[model samples]
Each structure stands twice: as C-alpha cells, then as structure tokens.
Target: MSSPEQWTHPEPGEGPAARAAQPSPEQVIAGLRATTEGGAELTQLLTPEGERVASPQFDRYVADIDGEALRGLYRDMVLVRRADREANAMQRQGQLGIWVPLLGQEAAQIGSGRALRKQDMAFPSYREHGVAYARGIDFRELMGIFRCTDHGNWDFKAHGFHPYTIVIGNQVLNATGYAMGQKFEGKVGDEDGEATIVYFGDGATSQGDVHEGFVWSAVYDAPLVFFCQNNQWAISEPTERQSRLPLYQRARGYGFPGIRVDGNDVLACLAVTRWALDECRHGNGPVLIEAFTYRMDAHTTTDDPTRYRLSDELEAWKLKDPIERVRAYLARNGHADQPYFDRIQAEADQFAADLREFTFNMPEPPPERVFANVYAEPSAALDAQREEYLAYLSGFATAGER
Candidate 1:
C-alpha cells in the first residue's frame, strides 16, 4: 500500500489520482449515487467503538502519545458530543434561537484542538463548540450567542481563542492577518513563538473570503493552518454541488501542502494538526487540512434533515461516531471498562447540569451598556444623537419614570 507520503501530493497540474483516474465519469457519478443510496460510507478513523488504526503520515505522532493521552482524547470527544446534543435540545425547546450540532465531527475538532500549544491561537466558525471546550471556555458561554444575549463575552487574548466568527470564512482572513503580524514580530520560526489555526466548513470553501485568505497566507508565508472539516453537507447542499475536485487538492495550487485526514478519528486529527502546527512553527508557512467527516445532524436546530437528506445516510455516519470508536478501541485493548465508562457519563451529566444552571441564571446586559462602548471617546454629534434616542425611548415611559 502507498504510504501517506506517497499520497500526500499529486503531480503538478494533475488532479487527485483516485478522483481523476476513476474508470469513467459514469463511475464517479455512480460512486456519489451510491453514497446517496446509502451503499457507501464516508472516510473514518475510529470504528463505532474507538480503536487505533494506523495511517502512515499520522503514525509518527500517534506512536509518541501515551495511552492516557489517548483516553483523554476519547473523553473530550464524548463530552463535546454530549454538549452538542444538549445544545440542540435546548434550541428545540425554544431556549435558544438556533444550535449547530457537531454531532459526528467531535474527533475533528477535539483532535485538532488538543494539538494546540499554549501560545498558539485559534479562530473558529460558529460550529466550533468542541474547539471552545478544548480551549477551556465554559460550554455555557457558547449559549450566549445563540440565546440572543452577547456577541462574544470572553477575552480572546486571555483564552487564545477568538470569538466564533459567524460570517462564513471571514475568520480565515483574520487568522492569516494575525499570523502575518506574528511573522512581523519575529514569532514564526522559534519553538516558543505562537502559531494560528482557523476552522471553516466545507461550504465556506466556495466563498471568496476563503480564497482570499489562502492568497494572503501563502504570499506572506504566515504561520497559519487552515483547517477545513468537510462534513459532506453545506446546509442543504452536498459536497458535489460545491466543487468538482476534492477540496484538499486546491491547496497545492496556492503553493502550500494539503492533507486529507480521517476526521472521524481523534488520534489522526490530533496527529495531523500537531504536525501541521509544528511545520508552521518551523517556518513552513501555511498548511491546509481537509478533515473528511460527516455532519450526522441537521445544519442547525432550525433545519430539517428529512427535507433534503435521508435517514439511512445519517445511519451510515452513525457507525463511524468518533466517541464510540475510541470507546470500542479502549475496551478491546482492556484499557477501559464499564466503571470508566460510568464515571465519564457521570462527569458529562454534571457538566450539562452546571451549564443549564449557569445559562438560566446568566444576567442580561443593561440596555444602555450597548451604547457605552460604541465609541472610544464621546463626540458632540454622537452625544446629541444619543440624547435624542434616549428622549425617544423615554417618551414611552410612565409618569413615575421621571
């Protein structure tokens, strides 16, 4: 079998051999048809129960990690999945306006998130709840945005996690720009200097900002990693509707290396991301990681998967659930048992209960507080406008309001 090194790059100007060398266009079409027909499954790293599978490129890193670390990685996936489920349920119960469930992509997020060094920073899309969890942000804080409260209440500098960017792919440019700043500050080469990672979805690949992000990162040799979790669907559209070629292949065109990792495998995701970040820290410029996984839930709580997809398709992905696969592997290896499983479940439940209490008790910001920080300094014109607005608001106040 060809090693990951052999599969890492294609001949210049040639497409991915597996994709391009398919016997016929009819075969390609048939393969996609099979996926939709529930005959084919997406790439996966862990089985429904967690077990370690070897991949040539990732073997180097995974070999060095201890069994305890592997168990921790598995635990992170489980906790994140539980949080995703709770958020979805909260949204459905009308407690939140919307929720994006990271149901099947926990490995992609957790693995990559765990790979970050303390100095490294991450820019995330709104669906990056797992990343947020890894960064030590309280999961309930994520509810603030979807709950129609604050934009981002956390400090990015303190946590090394930027506020989740809702505008598709916009954070890519911001991440690149920050990395370029780091390079200017002489922070790209040394082991101690910071690196940046940005996450975006497969659908965002079609946007202009994503392309622009690539251009800037490549041109400046920024210490940035563009992590794309290709979860098969972009809202209601399938990957086929977005591009003809696999998304990873696009990286070579811009003078950077790209790797497609089985995103469903936490170990693989961690290995790949750690390697990519180290490459950047070593002055290798930017790298793109296309994490091949699936979104086993609706695009958001407001979405109806049944309207545009099939139950069998979701079932196929369920077999590759990131958390289950690790658990399976651990059990098989005699590294984990029912007691360990019970403890983890209890921890997850406690987390959910704490989050529920915190979310319900979250204090609302005062209405005038919105205007307090709108400007660095007060201007006469702005002050007059504010006064007029206050007057208009007070017009509706009762006699005791003064």
Candidate 2:
C-alpha cells in the first residue's frame, strides 16, 4: 500500500495538463456516471437491456451456455435474491443479529461461482449468498451464522466453499496461503490443475492484508484469482474515495493482469472468470477481476444508505437490474414463457418460506459455545475464561425464580 507521501498530488492550477490529469471531485463523480454503461474497458457480453453483445475473445469461454443454461442462471439469481430479501426481513423482525444483503450483486457472485470447478476452492466475503447457493451449500446452513447461532458450521472441504469471512480483505491472505500450498504441491500446469478464487469488495483494496496477499501470491505465482466485487461503494464512501485509478488497474503494479467486467452481466463475469482460472491452472497465476456492480440495499440492516447517498443513484442502478436483464433475455429469445417465469417466482417464494421457518425454529445456542472452537487443543487459560463467563451468565436469575 502506498503512503500519503508516495501519492503524487498536483497543486491547484499547476497547469492545464496537470488539471486534466488530476480530476476534480466533480470529475471523479462524473467518472462513476459512465460506469453504469460500463466504459470501453469493461468486458460485457450481455447488455442491461437484454441485448447480446459480441465478445470475440471471450465467447469461447461461455460457448456451452445455451438458452437452457441462460434460464438456469436466471433461476439461480431469482432464488438467491428471494432468500436475501427473506434474510433482510428476518433481521428487521429480530430473527437475526444482522444481515448483509447481496441484492444487486447476484450476477457477479453467481456467474463467478458457477464457473468454479469441483476441484477449485472459493473464499468468500460475508455478502456472498448467491455464491453460496451456486456452491451447492444448503441455504439453511447459512442462516445460522446470521442468526448468531453458529460460526458457519458448514463443511468447507466438502462444498469447496470456505466459511464466510466477516473481516474485509482477510480472506485474500487466507486464499493466497491456500493457493500457495496448492502450487507447492504441484497442483498447477495442466487442464485439471486446481485454482482458488478469493472474493473481496472494492473498499477492501485499502487493507494492508490485501496488499500483502497480492505481493505474496505474485511472488509465489500462486494459482489464485482475486475477485473484487466493486459494488461502487464501500458501505457509503464511493470508489473514487478509495482509489484514483480503477481497482482492477491496481493489479498491474503487483505484476499481474487485471480486467474489469460488467458485474450485472452474468455471461461476461462467467466468461472472464473461466479465462482467469484457466490461466491460473496452466501456471500463469494471479489475475485480478473487478466486477463493476452496485449494492442496491443498505450496507447492512444496521446502516442507512439514505443518510449518505441519494435515492436517485439507486434508481439509476435499478435500470440495470441484474435479474431483470436475464429475464428479459430469456423472454425475448422465447427460451422461457410466462408460465416458467411464474413457476420460478412461486418456487422462490416457497424457498423463502422454508428459510423463514428454519430461522424461526432455530435453536438458541448456549453462550459457552462461543469458546468451543477458539482452539483445537485444550487450553487452561481458555477453560478458565469460559468458566468465568459461565459464572457471570449464571448470575442472572430466571423470571420464574424471581
């Protein structure tokens, strides 16, 4: 990470060249305005209006995706979105401690997630519900974490999906280490070689851990793909505040290739990710992909977007709804009819209902359970602390006793 001193700050009115080079605040905001359309640098195979765009270079990656596959992707997004909305409502109803809504970024997650081979592993940030669904993890398994009952108890090795990482950019280091281990074990250099993908947000790029992960992975040539879901906001602060250059462009400095893709376009994300993973499998490791998407909901159930950003910005993004575009594409192509759409919606509703029932009936975990997984080996110190906590908890009398 570069320090303040390392950053080149051109003084005001240095020259016309300097002014043009260093954009003003308004210019930075204006740059984001163009992101909705995804500038020339963004790789997009499907337009937001359901138009299919030609991508000569990457078409082969997704050539196997026919109308049926497209419909499947659409179904995946719908179900994921429904489950997300259900979780949000659960949080509001006091069923969960907090909920991280992955409302508009479904395409970015599902596209990349579906691209992963059974041999490949994924390290996900907290808001990767869509990815979790694509990974074949039971959706019910995820609710326990948000409900504060379990520490993501799902078996990682079986599903090839790591436990949700709550800390920003921390997963990058973990993923890098894992990928380095794979490289050391001679897992690369063939079509069947293993690769790892780590998910992080645009805001996480500021973390020193992420920088360290990048340097280490590059040095080791680890079979890793740095997946950045650049949802345009790091919980309220815009991307401009995080970096002057696009997040993907930052990969060049770390000695790797970086590309931006339309996050709303699932096809583009799938194609780009497949290409990156293929490169890693063949020993050309460490690619950075910035999925230019938007987070349509609050950062979490605890935060309010209205306090910082305008509704108009969100409305503009609504025009590029990830799920809507896919539905449009399926409808216009006659691959799916009104009946299929209705059936999917009904199924999504039923999925949400099942999740709601599970959440409502979730067993309350004992407070001492938090100490269970702190260490693999028994520790006297941990035991003492746990006993002390248990004693403190026991001090409270039940209403019946009172």
Report the C-alpha lDDT of model 1 over 1-402, residue by residue, as the tens digit: 122212223345534444433324444444455333222223334555665555665577667667677789878887888778877777777788888889889999999998998889999999999998899888888888988888776767788999888899999989988999988899878777679999999999999999999999999889999999988889998776576556887898999988887788888788889889988987897999988888988888878878887787788778877788888888888888999989998888888878777766778876555565455687788777778887877787755576
Error of 2 at 272 (Å): 0.7
In model 1, what are the clashing residue pairs, if there are any?
Answer: 48-324, 48-325, 49-324, 49-325, 49-328, 50-325, 50-326, 50-327, 50-328, 50-329
lDDT against true structure, model 2: 0.89
Candidate 2 vs. true structure, TM-score = 0.89
Report the number of the highest-lDDT candidate.
Answer: 2
Would you estimate the TM-scores of all the predictions? 0.86, 0.89
- Tell me the tens digit of each residue's lDDT in model 2 across 9-66: 3335532211534655545445546556556588999888999999999999999999
Q: What is the number of residue pairs that collide in model 2?
A: 0
Model 1 has an lDDT value of: 0.80
lDDT of 1 at 256: 97
lDDT of each: 0.80, 0.89
